[model samples]
Target: MRARIAGVAAYLPEHTLTSAGVEARVRAAGGGYRPHPTIVERMTGIASRHVMRDDQQASDLAAEAARRVLAERGTGPERLDLLIFGSASQDMVEPATAHIVAAKLGATCPVFDVKNACNSFLNGLQMADALIRTGQHERVLVCTGEAPSRAIRWKVRDRAQFVDAFAGYTLSDGGAAMLVEAAPDGGIFYRDFAAVSAAWQVGTLPGGGSMHPRDPEFTYFSGDGRRLKDAFVDNGPEIFCTALEKTGLTWDDFAIIGVHQVTMPYLEVLRSILDIPAERLVVTLPEHGNVASASLPLQLDTAIRSGRCGPGDRVALIGLAGGVSLGVIFAEL
Candidate 1:
């Protein structure tokens, strides 16, 4: 048996932030470092991105997306056997955010959380697939509410600090949901992951965890952007090949490929390495920015809804997270 995606949906916050707006903010913040509006737009290929209200929590976003997916799948929350909340943002530090999301959606299913930075949603999909394939669960709902805008370090101390947090500028807010169930076929054809734990410190939120106490003004994003590119360029070929090998399909077999929404440059690198043509690739970064874990599914939903993909089509979703993890999931729709 295979775990097939019955439906997919996404929710984007109403407020939109443009690169020029970000430039204005940076200038007003009195940071010694300044980011040019055109530079951000040219480098990341992002003109605008959605932003959730400051009052809203990640669970709220997740619930909105999940409700849409449940309705589209022709089922209620009561039909879900398992609910997975996969996001970089959580409602709180104590109780799992999954419980809050479940309550919001009126779902009484077993709920849990998965946190793998930007790869959380893909991780949840793999778990859901395993459960369905093993007959442990029939229907599973995976959702992510990524609000990276909340943690962005706006007041940069210097040029170096600003450069380090440049990736954070691309962060956006969004949610996505997918429903998977046991079926005879038409599901995830192959899935796999690779990690370089030694490079885990490459991307980080320094002040939120145990090592560093929370500081509202100091909650800045940090990462070695060059190192991330180097890692991807180095490991992408082998990791992607392994997944294709498992499915006995290559880049030529996919109708559309969704790579992580980091930046246009990163996508270009992957496109070259994976041998995926520009026409066959889906580029959402220009419009959505990086919504973290929600990005992959959101892109997939956009592709399907826009008629870029249809039933019986093969698609691939690739993920890269802060732990420097890489994953590929190929599915048939």
Candidate 2:
């Protein structure tokens, strides 16, 4: 059985944060010499990023996206059989984000959350695939939202803090929704997916967890959790290579590669290391930055709506995130 996207929609907060604007704010706040925001953004080809209002969290952005997607698909919230929230910045820890989305969208169906750092959405896709395969649910609504920039520690604490702030500048808040149905439809169809984790490698949100032993007053966090970039880079080659091997195809089979984009540096590294062509990969992080789990879907929506998709077009969705996990999956558009 093929799990396909029935409809898709996205929501970017009203605010667009430009690199120049951020640089100005940092300079006015008495920060030392920092590279021009354009200089940094140029590296990723990103022009601007969106930040949600203080009152908004992942739930709000996700619900809005879900509503739009269902409406555009000519479906109602009541028809949704399954709802999944993929996120790292959920509104609460006790109750899953999917519940909140269901409440907001008036969905009384089975709702849950998928958490796996940046790979949450891919994980959700994998789960939805299973439900479709087993006939447990005919249709599932997958949603993702994140605001890594908002949680970034902007204050200069030490050398480690600099990397955290550096990473933060590349993060933006956004939401994406895709209504997936168990049908061999005209839309993109899910193929295969896999995930692996190495938790000791990289992490954020060390405050509340028992492993960190946090003391907000006495304890401090630098956010540059030790070679986080290296951890991701190290896993890049084997991940994509494995995906290709499983599909019994070569780089030539694909038209575009949509990887979990965090920076231009990472994209270049992946391209060179994975043997994927420069033109085959799509880069949106510079303008959208790292919109968390919504990264790939938002790009997919843009490509499809812009008339960039075609039959027999093979595409890869690669994801990397919090658990120090990496995922690469094949899909037909």
TM-score of every candidate: 0.96, 0.87
Among the numbered candidates, top TM-score falls to 1
lDDT of 2 by residue, 197-303 (tens): 65543456665557655566213223443366677666556767876776688877777677888777777776788888777676777778888788988877776
* Clash counts for the predictions, in order: 1, 2
The alpha-carbon deviation from the true structure for residue 332 of candidate 1, after best TM-score superposition, in angstroms, is 1.5
Each prediction's Cα lDDT score?
0.87, 0.74
Write one digit per residue (lDDT tens) for candidate 1, span 110-161: 9999999999999999999999999999999999998888877777778788
Give the range where candidate 2 is weakest over 10 consecutive residues by summed lDDT: 217-226
- Model 1's alpha-carbon lDDT is 0.87
Q: Flag clash pairs in model 1.
A: 312-333
Q: Give candidate 2 regions above 4 Å deviation.
A: 28-39, 42-45, 158-160, 184-201, 211-226, 310-312
